[model samples]
Target: MKKFNYQELVDSEQALQKRSIFWDPAIYEEELKQIFNRCWLFLGHESQLPQPGDFIRTYMGEDDVIVVRGKDKVIRAFLNACTHRGNKVCQAEGGNTRSFTCSYHGWSFNTEGELAGVPLEKEIYDNLPRERFGLVPVARLDSYKGLLFGCFSESAPSLIDYLGDIAWYIDVVTDSAQGGLEVVGAPYKTEIPGNWKLPVENAIGDGYHVAWAHAGAMSVVGAIGNGRSDNVLGINANNTGVDQSGAIEIVMNTHTVLTTLDGQSGYALYDHPEPVLAHLERNRPNVIEKLGELRGRQLYGSETHIGVFPNVQIIQGLNFIRIIHPKGPGKFEVWTYAMCERGMPDATKEIIHDHVRQTFGPAGLLEGDDGDFVEAITHSAAGYATRQMQGFLGMGMGRKAPWDGPGEASPGLVNEACQRGFYNQWRRTMEADNAYGVIGQTAPVTPVTAVLKEFRHG
Candidate 1:
């Protein structure tokens, strides 16, 4: 009747136990404290809260939160629930408001989270403890390049240290243009019946599925590969060289990046106009100067995929960002955003947004295909016997060799190195007794000396 120990459930260096990790309610509860509470989870972007009084309602773990820009032009998040009866104070998803009023009662709180209004100040209770009932604020909040993040634990690491080498990779997309990037419009919000980790793992470094799981979708978009052999499965048929030596997969702590380095050939799937394409070319010097020559060549006009630790995924080539909000052990809310270059032409922005919506948005066929598989895994893993077995992550374990670059680089684009790295970090955090100890550690250093021969950047 007892299951394996938590250590046995997640042998992230090799494999992970399929069932208990995915279906156990106890482990999920532990995740809330050890993982979500301690980590810097993504909140809304600064672009969304550009003006004072602007606000957007989002979540940190299962807790409801409202990110608001106060009159002082400072962004802060408070618990969305009113302190009086625990009723929701702000019902609107987002708006510019001076204060939030509870629908259940007349208790009102100002943008700064101060108790400002009460139904009966001196009539019912004679003297009300207004100061004691103010809405609670999140323990810690920080941002990186306009991407806001909040942590429930005060002792959590600074957001920069938390990002580590992955920040450099993110700068490729976030800092590509002179003015940086901005979300085109509201996010495409949808709920899916799947574990939160399912999408995280897939986004990080699951290029293996694109050729197979999305083969039909790719065919519709005329991206199924030019003159490549297409069997009934139509997989591994892309001759675009995106999966060849041009593709590099790097696993950095919990974050992962898969980038194509073979020049402009990587944009074969995109149909942007010449002017739009030239925008990236104009920014080539910025990338080269910010990142070294190696990363510069790899990221410029290249198809890039990124997974930011616990739950943020970005496809730089496609100009979209995905935030996965865990609902429970079996469900999650997927927030997809169309990210456009800040100073780009209006037509370019429209092209980016419309293309993103057609390919990976809520109504996208590619999303539908991914949902089917994600739900299937969660649905079938609930079996009593299946929980006893484990899932394989040994794809490119020993195939990782040192590169003349940053992060842990492996050979194949479809490798499981990133997946293994993800689970390994998850296991360490989930098993730690103290959140401070986990966040206090320095950024993980990949021992390149042990992994490959000495090489120099030309």
Candidate 2:
């Protein structure tokens, strides 16, 4: 096993990332231990297991975990491995079950992960104590605005502290809803032939690719091509006054009426369409007020997007949360959840779901475009010369500054703020000795933010 000098590889501000970080098995192993084990990773949402006996199986890196709602109504998570002879405890993805039975042996565990039964305990090992062999539970678990996260390291900071300033951004979207956001259903799971970090980095705020990489999709949607839509090059452009290249506006107006939509707020509004409005109208004014008219309109009519760090990417306008799980240095398993508000009308939900399926799922058009680029980039790094060459992230390097506005804004769709912010944070996390150190560092800008600020006050 190759040991890496974590500090040397990641501490400097301008140092380019070593290509081996993406393709080396030994480095990946260290990431699993140093990063995944210590940092709070997003588990499935609370809605996935709302009732007792309901459970969903998910991954924390490569380790399998069962997220369950206990009889006490509290949520809990446990390793899927059976304590008796080490067999997998659950085979299916998610469902309501009284107990999980290990197929190899008849050992059973309840919703709370307590060892409930052992088939023929008297016959096996002269009656081994059931209390001594319950399923292993994760060290820490917490939720922020309905999104649950877990960590194998007990010393990790609370989920709120870990989220830090990013929580403010998340709240702009999640808390915008009256009842808060919920996952639509099970994730649309699939695999991609690229490193896991590629997709995560892309969605962390890579707006530069939307016009070029997803040009075909944009053209089909009746919007002008990103570059052709407007004759602006690099970061600065018109529209919102943020750097043009870094900001790609999706559905800013409803029938020519301009309305800016925040990611989570848009989700709540869209999830509950006309039918939900009627339902609310029948109730009371307070209920209707909770679902504000403009917010509701934006929800049903606007877009949703997210900048969740490390590995989750959500596009509310696109209606999916893409989770990238690293299978190996060169392989990734991409899981997408087609989400909407819980009480949304069936017709509206279906429309959003179908739209998401067509745009970003396993066989979707836009997904195909991005997958090609990710794989090609990973492959190109194989050449010694190519690996030595530094990739460009200076599209709007020193451009952004603090904005005194309702939300962070930027200009064009080609800025590098998002990608830069992601890498900056990634470098910090990888270099830190623990999660606390990672969260304590200064806030970094996504490429869009950097460029917009630069132009505003450069």
Candidate 3:
């Protein structure tokens, strides 16, 4: 693949050349090399593989992988391809298994990915060195707060370093619950007829579209997405009836966070029961003392929308985490997981599940709107005239200002600052010769310091 200068495609902080990058197969091919192949992609959470031999089928880019808990109680991942004939070795999504045997040739591999049994062994051909034919493991694997992430490139930075300041913000949910978080049920998986990047941009706190695209669904969930909020982004208090102003829009590295400062608790949107509210309320002082006044207040109320660069998007108020996988230039799949406090009652979990399903799953009322919108964008780009034009993203340009806050603080939820940040990082990664080179280099336009690095918000 030719090394396309992503900087030229991105133009500047305020503008982006949309058509060539969004719909071109050539661009996607290069992205597979520079971005997907080099980054630390999230695989499965530790909670998903609780016991020895438990495993789950997941993807890193388009490559199928089997993540398993070994007999030694260590987690590992291997390419799900047989050493012979390139046949898929595992088909099931997840279950406990002592070994995975290729259905085609009957070659078996143990949980540690060592070649165990071969159909012919010493009979058909001189017993080949079995040790040399074990399942091919990924280059590197690591975890942060129980979230498993694997990197195909050995040169990639450490998982925590790659996460950067975004880790500090994500811990609000990952570290908040008493026993940490877990995937409650099977993921809601489905294909979206749109470029994978579109969804990533949306989840990076795309407050601009929520009020318009999901206006109807917002009414059903709560008044949160209605225009009653103090800002155009409709990020007011959960009880939308009350009038309040002030919203926090923060862009850190490739991550984006949107929070409403309206005094009402974010729990109101979920209709959270009093006990749920009290639990967080009881622990509020600790988080407050840890994160200081502003961030602590924001963390206390579940009123933030966050997206960790490349793929993972989390909505604290909605209690949902989604991982976007690129299937092709114009198609992608989203794996949705419902999250709740570990010790919550069954009834409470059920309620949380229902809410998450109704709001963000494949058939989710609000999610349906976003799918249609992004798909429309993809379809429109097919026309020759549309493909020749450049797209505008100058929302709140020249408005970003350094604040004493945690990340790159900016005002106005409707701004495209996060989109710029996303493309900027994309350019950096694509420009680098290797993944480790991506460290210490963000959008060149600004310098990032974790001012609150020592603050343990949760």
TM-score of each predicted structure versus truth? 0.89, 0.79, 0.88
The 10 consecutive residues of candidate 2 with the worst lDDT sum are: 250-259
What does candidate 3's lDDT look like per residue over 1-458, in tens digits?
Answer: 43675656777754676666778888888888777887888887889899999999988888899999999999999999998777888999999999999999899999999999998678887858888899999888999888899988754677888888878777777766556787865699989899898888887757677656776765666444443333223443332432223555677765677666442345544544455566677766766776666556655455666777678777676777888999998999999998887866667667778878877888888788888878878768888889777777777777765455568766656677777777777776767755655654532222223223212210
User: Against the unseen true structure, what C-alpha lDDT does each candidate score?
Assistant: 0.75, 0.63, 0.74
Residue-level lDDT of model 1, residues 23-135, one tens digit each, is 77778877777778878889878989988999999888898999999989999999899999999999888879999999997899989898999987778886787899999
lDDT of 2 by residue, 1-458 (tens): 22676444443356356565666678778777766776788897887888898889889888899999989888889999999788999999999998999999889998888999887777756767778889999878998868889888665567777766556445534654446567866888877777777887676556567556766665553123333333222322233233342233221100001112321222222323344335334432433255454444333323434555567765555556777888877888889987766655667567667767776777776677888888877777777777655555666554543333233344334555566556666665666654565665443433676446434421
Using alpha carbons, what is the TM-score of model 2? Answer: 0.79
Q: Sorted on TM-score, highest at the top, how do the candidates line up?
A: 1, 3, 2
Residue 261 lDDT, candidate 3, scale 0-100: 48
For residue 62, model 3's alpha carbon misses the true position, in angstroms, by 0.6
Candidate 3: segments with Cα more than 4 A from true spot: 224-245, 261-265, 271-275, 289-294, 401-403, 440-458
lDDT of 2: 0.63
Model 3 TM-score relative to the real fold: 0.88
